[model samples]
Structure formats: structure tokens, C-alpha cells
Target: MKRTVLPFVLLLAAACGPRYGMRVPDKLVEKLPYESRIELLESENDLALAIDTVDEASNEVLRARDAIRRAKARESAAEEEENRAADTASREVAKLAIEEARARVTYLRAKQRLNVGLRDVEQLALRCAFARYELARLQSTRKAKVEGSEKLDVKKYEGQVSQCEAKVKEERAELAEDSAQEKTAREAWEVKKAALAKKTFDARASPYVENL
Candidate 1:
């Protein structure tokens, strides 16, 4: 009977184990400050990556714009030379259309990337603000708990807390604008992608479509 009961208890434990995984207990003192510091560090690292992404995306946008300009110039030259030869002009125009479409796609993708990077930066900014608030709250709590200490008095943490609260408010205020910009980027990308998809379909369906 004892062995059977032990097996049943082990099975119950195994069934419950996966729900929460391993739960590590924290120390009783100053957990909020410690956790907030960790979050702040992580957000700062992510913000660095987001900035790099924005830079790369900006460069890609420039390259794509240059490509579009070159393609347009070539198309213009081809149009001017159309009176000399009809067949060659048609092929050249088709080729330039494809090139322009591809360049536009690249530009749209770069824009989307930039938008995502900006959104990430805004989100991380908010996260950092919240973390700062948490750390300040912890400091205020600790200071209030201290007794007979001139350096760490009850009123000492108020300024820090107020500054952190202001930062949080500023971040929140920008959230709506950030969201709108991201939405605009997404909508533009989708529209351009759909239009380009139709052009691609038309080009593929053409029997005259060649390597160019």
C-alpha cells in the first residue's frame, strides 16, 4: 500500500511540474530595485541594436532611392530612342519597369524596417521609464523605512521618484504617435506589396517575358 501511494504521489508531482517550471525564490530585501536594474540593462542593450537597425535601414533606403533614380533615367532614355527601333524599345521599357518595381519594393521594405526599429526604440524607452520608476519606488520605500539617518531621510527619495514619474509620463505621451507611425508604415508596405504583386503576375503571364 505504501509503495502504491508513493507512485501515485510521484505521478501527481510530475503532472504539476511543467505548469510553472522551476521557480527560483528571491531574497526578501530590495527585489524590486534588483529586478529593475536588470530590466534597464536589457532594455539599453536592445535599444542599441534598434539604433543600429535604423542606421542600416536608412542606408538601404538611400540605395533603393538611387536605384529608382537610375532606373527612371534609363527608362527615359529608352523612351526617347523608341522612334529608332520599336521592338528593342519595348523590351527595354519592360526591363526598366521590372527594375523600377524591384527598387520600389526594396525601398518599401527598408521603410518598414526603419518603422519597426523606431517602434522598438519607443517601446524600450517606455520599459526603461517603468524600470526607473520601479527602482525609484524601491529607493523611496527603503528611505522611508530608515530611521535616524540624515543622509537617507524619508524625504530624500521624493525628488528621484518625481523625476522617474515624469519620465514615465513623457514616454506614455509619445506612445500614440509611435503607434500611428508604425501603422502608417505597415499600411504603405502592404499597399505597395499588393500593387507590385499584381505587376509581377502580369509580367509573368506575358509570353514575351524574357531574362531581362
Candidate 2:
């Protein structure tokens, strides 16, 4: 009976073993910020690479948004070009019916998609802002908690605290700049879209305007 119970207990232990291999406990990994840090680029080549990286990352996202507006404008122009060609071929209706209405709708949809991307980046900026807010809150309360634990008293870890505050400052500044650019990009896109709508409307309605 004892031997049989031993086997059953071993089987239970085996079943209870971790299913996805070994994983570091969260508590252990959580304190690893001190160990891992971003190194600032120093070499000339590294600086150039950093610029390229920035262009590809944040700058490219904004550029892609601008391109969407341009693409929609292109489609609207293409419609007018086709209508012009049709007018030259035969003047049956005095104006070839162009899909200006549909073009505007498509442009609007593209803008909406870009807006979604813009919002996502905006939220990301907000997240960074929140992180900075938390750090600032912790820092502000440190004087009162100076007698408390090492973690509570910011002065106890002055170097680390200052470094981290600097980190937050840099991150907040970068994110704010990005948010501002995103806002500007959105405003520019809106202005272009509005102008395109009016221009396309005029182009499509010109034949009737000329007749009147």
C-alpha cells in the first residue's frame, strides 16, 4: 500500500510541474531596471544610424499619414483626368460623369484610417505622460517619507532617482514633440482634404457651371 501511494504522489508532482518550461518569477524580473539601460549613441556612425532610425520610426509614421491624403487627392485628380479625356472623345453630355462623390467618400475613409493611427500614437504619448506623472508624484512626496524605507525616500537613491527623472524628462519631451507633430499632420491633412473636396466639386460641376 505504501509503495503504491508513493508512485501516485510522484505522478501528481510530475503533473504539477511547470507546463511551459522554466520562467523567471515576476518579482525577480521586476527589479531588473537597474541592470538594463539604454546606451546613448556616441560614435559618428551611430549618430547617423540613430537619425535613420528616428526617420524610419516616428517620422515615417507621420509621413505615411501625409501620403494617405495625397493618395486620395490623386484618386480625385485621376477621375477628373478621365472625365477630361472623355469630354475630348465625345461631347454627348457636355461633361463626362465623374465619380467625384465617391472619390470624396474614399478620401474620407482614408482620413479616418489615418485618424485611427493618429489616436494610437496619441494614446502612446499619454502613456508616457502618465509614467512621468507617477515619477513626479513619487519624487514630490519624498521629503515627507525621508525617514521611511529606502524605496520611499528618493534621496536614498539620489543618483538613480535623478537619472530616472532625467529619463522621464527626455521621454516626455520626445513624446510631446511627437504628439504635436501628429496634431499638425492631422490638421494639414484636414486642410488638404477640404480643399480637394471643393476643387473636385468644382471640376465635376464645371460643365454645368459653364452651361449656366
Candidate 3:
């Protein structure tokens, strides 16, 4: 039993000795060199990624600023275009207003002239009616006085009455025509005046704020 125990203890001591011999000394070994290199490489890689992120963010900011500038420029251009359009519209409206006013004045003048002519025709018709009535009364009295006494004179007077009647008829027709023409002229003037007045009101109330 003693011999067996001694041999086993010697074998255990030999195994422990070889195991201790396989380990390197602390002073001779490169301590944690691979781990330290990996750590430094990882830190440099992180810095490169951070720089790339910053560059991308700066590019985005520049793009946004450029877009904002373009938007403002477009807005300014649109405003200028609107103002130009308004100015053009104002000029056109003024020209139209002037033309309409001239037309209205001309129509009014024509209406006044027609009215004066109509009054003259009416007075002429009145004079013609009075003359025809007096001629008719003279013919009736001459016929009652004598049938054969100066028959030629009676025929002459009858012819004069017929001529006077024709004249009165012509005067009445002319007066009716003149009255109709006067009414048409008056209606035309009123229409033009109304249209011009409405246009003036619209111009005053418009957003452009310019008189036409």
C-alpha cells in the first residue's frame, strides 16, 4: 500500500510541473496587444462614421436653404406678375370707360336734336290742321250760296280744298314718323346712360381701386 501511494503522488507532481512549464512569464509576453489594437481600430472607425453623418446633415441643410430661396424667388415673381396684370386691366378699363362715355354723350346729343325736330313737326301739324278746317268751312258756304253762279270759281276753291286736305294728311304722317324717331333716340340714350352708370359703379367697387 505505501509503494502504490508513493508512485501515484509522484505522477501527479510530474503532471503539475509540465503544466506550469507551458505558461509564459508576464514580463516576456506582449500583454493584451491584439485587444488594445482592436479597441483603437474600433475607435477610429466610429470617428469616421461620425464625420460621414455630419457631412450628410450639412448637405441636407444646404439643400433645404436652397429650396427656401427658390420658393421666395418664385413668390416674388408671381406677385410682380399679378401687379402687371392689374395694371393692364386698369388701363383697358379706363379706355373702355372713355369710349363708353363718348358714345353716351353722342347719343344724348342725338336725342336732343330729335326731340327738337319732333316739336317742330308737331307745331307744323297744328298749323296745317287749322288751315284745312278754314278751307273746308269756306267751300261749304260757297256751295250753299250758288250752284251755277261763278261755277269755275267754285271748282277752283274745291281744288284748293283738296290740295289743302292732302297737305294736312302729309303733315300728320310726317309728325307721327318724327315722334317715333324721337322716341327711339330717347330710348337709345337712356340705355347707354344706364350701361355707363353701371360700369362706373363696378369700377369704383372693384378690388383694383382705380377709376376708369
Best by TM-score: 1
How well is each residue in 154-185 modelled by candidate 3, as lDDT tens digits?
44444544654566567556656555655665
Pairs of residues clashing in candidate 3: none
RMSD of each: 15.2, 17.3, 60.5
Q: Using lDDT as the measure, which candidate wins?
A: 1
The candidate, 2 or 3, that scores higher on lDDT is 3
TM-score of each: 0.34, 0.31, 0.33
Runs of candidate 2 with Cα error greater than 4 angstroms are 1-98, 146-149, 152-212
TM-score of 1: 0.34
Off by over 4 Å in 3: 1-100, 139-158, 168-191, 200-212
Q: What is the lDDT of residue 106 in candidate 1?
A: 49
lDDT of 3: 0.42
Error of 3 at 3 (Å): 99
lDDT per residue as tens, model 1, 1-212: 13433353234334534321111112312443454445445434443443445456566556656655654564455445444555864655455455444444444455555555545445444333333333443454454443222334334334443544466567556556655654665465445444434444544443322211
Clashing pairs in 1: none
